[model samples]
Target: MKLKSFLLICFSMFFVVSTVQAATTISISVNGTTVKTDVAPFIENGTTYVPLRSVEQIEGLSIKSWNNKTKTLIISDPSKSMTFRVNNQSQSDSPLIKNNRVMVPIRFIARNFSSDVAWNAYTKTVHVAKINDKEKANLKSEDITESRIAAINIPIISTLKELTAGESSAGYFQLMFPEGESKNFFTIQNGIINHYQVKENAAWLTWSGIIGGNKNTNTFWVTNTDISSEVGQRPTSKDRLFFYNISEHSGQSQHGYISTNGEKTILGSKDMNSLNDLYPIPEEELKH
Candidate 1:
């Protein structure tokens, strides 16, 4: 009986240590290549903690929540966003920041957007990898355009129309790049314009715009599906035209809205995809 009790205690202790004090970023390997970041990640306590961002960025993905009702965080590249539960729940109050460190939920922080997570207790580490090719392909082909990080000659009018239509009125234009490319999208807004989704690798001559007599000017990277950090200060003609940005990983995008009103409110969040079908991609644009 004593031996059995000892084993139970040991097992319990291991679980606690493996999932405590939130996720911290540490060195990790992506596709057999090692990368590093300052983002906190999941580790075996004493073992090095690998940052999920490093893996996600290296893997060309991002992370977001499955829904508001659940505590799961969905890591996704352009191709897909897989769900994972954080062992611990986060508080509504903003995260505590000590010194230069910003604290976040462990489980949420450990998972990257658009990747699969496997926790190995024996090895005392968490493994992140691209989901199976079948799943990845399916996710990529579902919506939007695949975005490769490349310099795109985006015309101001084209970007303005796409942005105002997609974002200003609680809408978004789905985008993607070719497979196996890393890029970001950026935009500049002036007056009344709230935000823009610019591909990281895309280069435009002018991003500043005038909306309702307000001048909004800002640059951003649009290469991640989840842009939670960019949502704030609703841009209006009266109040500074806040320049919120959007981005996504490279893969099959659902080709729909990911946020509304400067907040990262994706299409799936408000059941927009379920209610009304996504807008049809125009025949001219569907040539791809």
Candidate 2:
């Protein structure tokens, strides 16, 4: 990578804060359950520090490997492994042990596990979630199959538009999990989506095809601070789209949207137009 581009990436990966929130009511919630610990998480420099050991408490998540000599922690299952080495206490993203508690970047697990992470200021909560179809079996959503749109008094679109990988301004990714059984495509961009409309905004979008391995599904997921909608409800900022499956560790993020742009876009689940809605991930997002 070019020096300039690498510098930009490194800068974006970090954060800075003037006031440290040590006494804040920060806590960790996995799947949907709050992770209990005598040692509560705290915020420093705009990054949340969580008990590294609190990770193991999460049922489905386990330490696949821990090399004490190297101070390396590998939180993994059959699907994913996250590596984080203890850096010097002065380093920004370094892991630290406090009062017999192991602390690391709070967002480390969520980012690596394909789970969505959010930090809410109003309620002072940290949300981490690895959502899936099995958990949402009760709140299931159906496709826009011809019948639904017919009642809306609108003409249906005959065909969806084609998507080309590497063509997106924001990079694209192939999120693979569910033990090699699912491959979801996400083309991320700093814009929101509206059904049958072409308006771009500042919020970022994580567009995908067939969320949770659902066949022929179009999901226009948002990753920002606005709480656009309520859970399992119509468009709002509070929604999130989890793409992987889980059985043992069902820890999800605290309920809130984290953003730098102060914008909220409604997450997609139900179809917008019978034919015209947000496009799906391009076929090229898949690995060869």
Candidate 3:
């Protein structure tokens, strides 16, 4: 009995350490304005987790209880009239509650609801722009665009920004860059890239079954190089496909020439047979 109890305790401890990372205070901004919430936001597995419900904010979001504590969270947007399971049992990414507070996946919510989300790596803040927030987000970016980094341009597409820019701006996207021929490109063996909202927090999943291949996630945060000391391992800035200026608008991208690290494989919309087809970001959306 004692041996069984010890094994159970070990499993519990492993679960906690694997799923949870260092808690950092996050700055929440919606439509370019700071928002105060009843409960602050936190990060897990490199994704930004927000309270399932905000106080007098996000009027469009509404939810029902967790089915008598089965640990399943359901949310709906009557404004958008969409619903989905929080745990997404079939998927690796799942919403969780800590400290008696339930947290929803902000990135997942933004993607389905037509929203844009950006992060300020230096200040460690988050920017969320809903359908209405887009105009405000654009204006906010304009205000700081001169002082902050401008939207990066993709060398191959010339018309589009780096794929990473969309994720940086949208805050949640699963991007993939397959191995193509490029002397400068990084992360050679092309496969789908599972991006952790934050680059440094990805290593925690090395032992987990969920990770597809973060090695293709060649994007790195050059400005906050030391930010991962809390996570013990430093994120590699080498072999990243793109690097942008580390400004509030740029989400603390590395300040320098925009990286053409992995554009060797031309990205297209209609032709999935081309190089690798990751999720497509609207062309106009790249400007902001």
Q: Point to the candidate with the largest TM-score.
A: 2
Q: In candidate 2, what are the lDDT values of residues 63-141, reduced to their tens digit?
A: 6777788888788855767777887463446676666666877676656655556664533556565544333331122
True-structure lDDT of candidate 2:
0.37
Error (Å) of candidate 3 at residue 139 is: 12
Estimate, for each residue in 118-236, the C-alpha lDDT of model 1 and write its tens digit.
Answer: 34332333434443444344333434333211112211111121222123322322222222221223322212222322322212212222332121122122222222223223322
Local accuracy of candidate 3 as per-residue lDDT tens digits, 140-233: 4433232111111110101011121112223212222111211112111112121211111011111111212243333333333212212212
**Model 1: C-alpha RMSD to truth?**
20.1
- TM-scores, all candidates, are 0.23, 0.40, 0.35
Which regions of candidate 1 fall more than 4 Å away from where they truly are? Answer: 1-27, 38-55, 62-76, 79-98, 103-114, 131-288
Q: List the residue pairs that clash in candidate 3.
A: 77-81, 178-190, 179-190, 185-261
RMSD of 2: 18.7
Q: Each candidate's lDDT (Cα)?
A: 0.30, 0.37, 0.35
If ranked by TM-score, best first, what sequence of candidates would result?
Answer: 2, 3, 1
Ranking by lDDT: 2, 3, 1
Q: After superposition, how far is residue 252 of candidate 2 from its true place, in Å?
A: 31
